[model samples]
Target chain A: MAEKHINARGLQCPGPIVQIFKEAQNCAAGDILCVEVTDQGFKKDIAAWCKKTKNELLSLEEEGGVIKARIKKG
Target chain B: MSENKKTIIVFSGDLDKAMASFIIANGAAAMGNEVSMFFTFWGLNILRKPEKIRTRKSFMEAMFGWMMPRGAGKLGLSKMNFGGIGAIMMKSIMKQKKVNTIQELIESARALGVKMIACTMSMDVMGFKEEELIDGLEFAGVATYLGEADEANVNLFI
Candidate 1:
């Protein structure tokens, strides 16, 4: 499976979420999506998204002023 | 529920209430929800032309009301009075946290296609001229809002 990358740093709340949805549309099963966001809003937002959409958050970690999250499309 | 495809209605225009509108609308829009912020009555004031809507009292309040950004932005907790000193406290916190202004959030929402509709009946009642509002705003009546609202699983009033 291939992993898609999204750099959403400096973008606020729904910005990352909107873009991620747009990006995920182009991906297929077994594909991985990694997003780099700045803070808590993304974590809250993405978590809820994953829950509702049935996607899986494979990994979430913080590094260098960025919050990294990965989701594997189920 | 379809992720990021919910609809929300914002019925308030107070500074604090507007903040709730901004946070909620943006929050929902972030979830990939096709958000529609049906701004009616006072809510339409946010899209008012920058120059036409001027503040009368509270210079500091006016400055924050005017300078910080208008409409959805004027709604921030910082710009609002959560309490006597709450506005001030929130402003400081926002400055420290680097959160986007309500205007910026609205702009971002538009960029993401978070359809924003201004209520026609409300505007008429309020005597707001078309030119006084921001560009790219979709104008519609109650029925229009309802058509979309009916399709949405999530609906809210603020």
Candidate 2:
């Protein structure tokens, strides 16, 4: 399985999600993407995006004020 | 599930409002929804060229062009403008937060296939030249906007 990492640490709401969407374009159906972000709004945004896009959100974690979301492209 | 179209009438040219409108447009487009934005009156200023294009125009037309904000980058805040300083401060905050600027958001929306329609009536009334606006815009009248709005599942007047 392929994996991708997106450093969205400094990005705000929708910026990180937009970046994830852009990156997800090149990935295969089962590829895993890890997005690192600092925006608190992303907690809900990513979940909603994955739900809308029919992707699988594997995990969401926060560490030292940074949020990381692991998603599997569907 | 079939109601997936979103149409927005962008009536304000203020930076913050424009940013909000574009953010919504982009988000909707990202979710595979059909998005259309109609620019009217002051909203047309968001699509103007950043630099003066030096097009030949009548004196009144020239004055109108000079008085309006040149482009997205030059737009002022809708509130607490503080003589243009507020816009500058807002830009700084956006940068620090890594939020896309209004210009960047517009580009993203376009790239996401959002239909950007410029109101010809507003353009004529506001003295905006066809060549002075950005590329890739579809020009139409109120009928077209109304048609799109009528079918859109989510219609907004901003």
Candidate 3:
């Protein structure tokens, strides 16, 4: 199953990060989280987090004015 | 032990940039990671009381001239020159769209245990008294900031 949430589209940089931090806490080992953001600064940032944490980024896409990211817990 | 912390050394008071620094530090802290913000020079202005803000705001404010003090208009990035009007308009739009104020965000960061440090040198230079700043700010020197920066998983200068 997939859990999707809208986060920090127009909020700001760390807004999305704050959402990711919270989600990472409740997530199971295999749970999927979709983060929708519009901050361009987060493109490299979220990728860096995935690489560092060993989590799997299932997908990253942009629709309209939002950056949608899907990540599966490691 | 928690994950390696992220340390940000902020030298500018530009609202947008400082807000970005605070957001990163607070985000990292909320994630069970340590976070520190080193405020230097113009960046220290954010910590000052509302009175000082008005004095600075008159000259530095880049957006909506009549907004409240301690508002986003006083931030370093949102200043009146170096692309002032556009940045101000964007900030006004962001505010209209429900972006949280910098002060509110700072409070959230503090609640999450993000460390806030103001530079002693900068304070001395600015001639700010302890009573002039908001409560609960930690003051220190470059060495202190550097020590934390050394152990940081991510170090940012904003």
Top-scoring candidate (DockQ): 2
lDDT of each: 0.71, 0.90, 0.72
How well does each candidate superpose onto the true structure, as a TM-score? 0.72, 0.93, 0.68
List ranges where model 2 is wrong by over 4 Å. Answer: none
Q: Candidate 3 chain B — worst ten consecutive residues by lDDT sum?
A: B60-69
Error in Å for residue A23 of model 3: 2.5
DockQ of each: 0.41, 0.63, 0.34
Across residues B7-70, which tens digit of lDDT does each residue of candidate 3 receive? 8888777777867877777767755677889888777777766654332432324242233234
The candidates, ranked best first by lDDT, are 2, 3, 1
Better of 1 and 2 by lDDT: 2
Over A1-74, each residue of candidate 1 has an lDDT whose tens digit, in order, gives 89889988877655677678778878998899999999667767788888866788888888887899999886
Docking class of 2: medium
> Total clashing residue pairs per candidate?
8, 0, 7
Give the winner by lDDT: 2
